[model samples]
Target: MTAPLLEVNDLKMHFPIKSGLFSRAKTFNRAVDGVSLSIQPGETVGLVGESGCGKSTLGRCIARLYQPTEGRVYFKGNDLVHLSHKALLPYRQNIQMIFQDPMESLNARHTVGEILEEPFIIHGIGDAQSRRRSVAKLLDTVGLPSRSATRYPFEFSGGQRQRIGIARAIALNPELIICDEPVSALDVSIQSQILNLLMDLQQEYNLAYLFIAHDLAVVKHISDRVLIMYLGQIVESAASETIYQSPLHPYTQSLISAIPIPDPHRKTNRILLQGDVPSPIAPPSGCRFHTRCPVAEPRCSETAPSLLEAETQHDARCLLINSQ
Candidate 1:
């Protein structure tokens, strides 16, 4: 098992909702509640769900951007939650994040070279000349030109900006990169290029990735395991191919069915899910998907299901499968 590279157990993050002039806490948005996951070294795990399902929040917690209200996040045998800001420095360098919007992530005033070199500077690596030399090679590694070092972010297209972001993330040579919707904003043609670039970088570095995206097809192409999140809870997790071929969770089945087959001749019984995702501030009791699940049993509304392996390594948090 290689003792999993990262282990997140019963992780929870709650944002308080305050009311009145005094701002007394009224309620809390349990953005992520009792979620658990693990990522082995050199493996890519994809987190997929509709918008506002807490995938990004989970990613941030794993990155230690937000303090978890509950549970533990262990990376390479170190507990991230207990680390003081100063003590967390080394872990920060080992885990990097690639944001969704490159334009927003990259500073407009900083040249490409400066942006990429900031990490090395923060971590205090390399001299000025060596840093400059590494900058050009990094640009080349991400398929950007060395001349790009001198240009502002606005001068490049969206794809190029993402490439620059990639260059910056890898500048420190981290082992894990949390990609938050990396290609959603790019045009289709450009998206493939970015995906391929990520693939190449992973192969070259033997890096692990926690790819968070709403796109199922994209996850299918890149991930070894796929996790389906809904209302801040994971409904299913399994080998990507297993989930695509025989999804155990009702929500997962619907999601996989929604993926469009390239061949028009092949038929797919698309399951268009009904009802909006329940609010995280007050998620539904028991099984969250009972309101929309076609095969939901009466007991589903009264008991929450824990994710457990049903066959080999396939896991699903659904009462139906638990009974079977």
Candidate 2:
């Protein structure tokens, strides 16, 4: 059997928050506490969670955009966590990122052609003429017209700009792409088009994806597996079908139940939590989800639950569920 293209082990990213004029005291916002997962070649792993749940931070860490606070990010047997910038250059070509806001990510000054060609230029892939040709192909690949390449980002609509971002990300033919809410900012109609484009590109290039999004329905459609995160930690990880069908974690169950049903005639039970997600800087004492978990037991508040396999190959971080 082939090995995974990416392996994240006990990964954490903590941003220090300074206080006071002298900044004598400092606190760390534990954006990502301990996230561990593996992604095989050409597989899509959907990361779903609420806002500020560290999904984007985790994606950035995997992309090596942010140096990890602790743990290892192994890609093809090498730990990327401590690799120097120069040392990591070669691996950069094998991994890429598509940020949530295309308007912010894309260079407003540069033409679409220039933007797409930047990756090849950075890696010194092909000469000027060849790079231009590659840029044209990338435009075509992302469903943008060749003429659009000469236009600046501001000239395009939100969806069009996102397509441009997608075009640029695949320009280097990276083995893995970290897509952080790539379609969330676009219209619902446009979101489908973008998702379809990504799937088509994945099939064409044999690409692997770390798809981060808040929309469970979208994740369900595109992902082979799903990872549910809360309070800077993964609460559950399982196959997409299994995660939706038999969610053991109360947090995961609540999230699934919240996905709107299309049929008005059908009745469904929605699991509503009591309060907001606790601040990651000072999270709950025991299970991070215990404060909001509807099915949380008395033991949940006193004892932290490690991520344990509740069923075959399916893991959840819940004492109540794991005990049963």
Candidate 3:
């Protein structure tokens, strides 16, 4: 196999949980706690979990948009975690992020052309005339008319704004792009179009993707590898087909079972998870999923299970499954 384009090792991002009459130190929300993975060049790795599972936080950390409290982010063998803001600029062009909400991500005041041109100016891609030429090409590449470039973000519809967001991401021709629910906001019909656009772009640019989403169906469609995260930790990492066909961890099983089947006659085993995800501020001592895992044993609440490989490259954090 080829060397990974992006490797995240024990990546952690903790937001301080402060609470007091005058605001004193309390605890921390362990958003991404000891998470690790890698993304090969031109491959798509999907990060799937519930809303507060720190999927988006991890994406931002990978893109260097948020500084991780602990752990290392290596892009093409370069350690990004230790790099200062000034030093991180070179990697910014190769790693871009598409936010979940197109409206919030794009500045309402800036025109489409201005938004796309910002990266060129920041990275010093070209002077006035050349940058202008790049802007027009980007607008057309995203399937938007060049005339739309002069219009503000508010004037465009949701899908159109998302297209603009995608154009900006590719303006630098990034080697890796972290997509934080890129198509979740749009209607179902528009979702497929955006997904197709992303697949096409990946093939055209040989780009890698760290796709963060809660929707398993969408992830299964785009991801070559899938990581199942829970309570800020990855419980399962395997090929997309393996994870969907034979999930190992209880959390993974439940998540897989939750995916709706298109066929009316197809009856599947539903592993419904009980209880809500534990508070990250005070995560369970050993296995964070023990609180809700139906197959959880006493050892689950006492000793944590490390992610161990099964057949080939598949891995999961579960004692019962691994022992089998």
lDDT of 2 by residue, 1-324 (tens): 589999999999999888877785478999999999999999999999999999999999998899999999999989998999999999999999998999999989999989998999888898999999999999999999999989999999999999999998899989999999999999989999999999999999999999999999999899999999998999999999999999988899998888789999978898888989899999988899888877777888899999999998799998887777
Name the runs in model 1 displaced over 4 angstroms: none
Q: Report the C-alpha lDDT of model 1 over 90-200, residue by residue, as the tens digit.
A: 889989999999999999999888998898898899999999999999999999989999999999999999999999889888999999999999999999999999999
Candidate 3 local lDDT, residue 230: 90
How big is the positional error of residue 279 in model 3, measured in Å on the Cα after superposition?
A: 0.8
lDDT of 1 at 171: 87
Output the worst ten-in-a-row residue range by lDDT, candidate 1: 17-26
lDDT of 3: 0.91
Candidate 2 residue spans exceeding 4 A from truth = none
Report lDDT per candidate.
Answer: 0.92, 0.93, 0.91
- Per-residue error for 29 in candidate 2, Å, reads 0.7
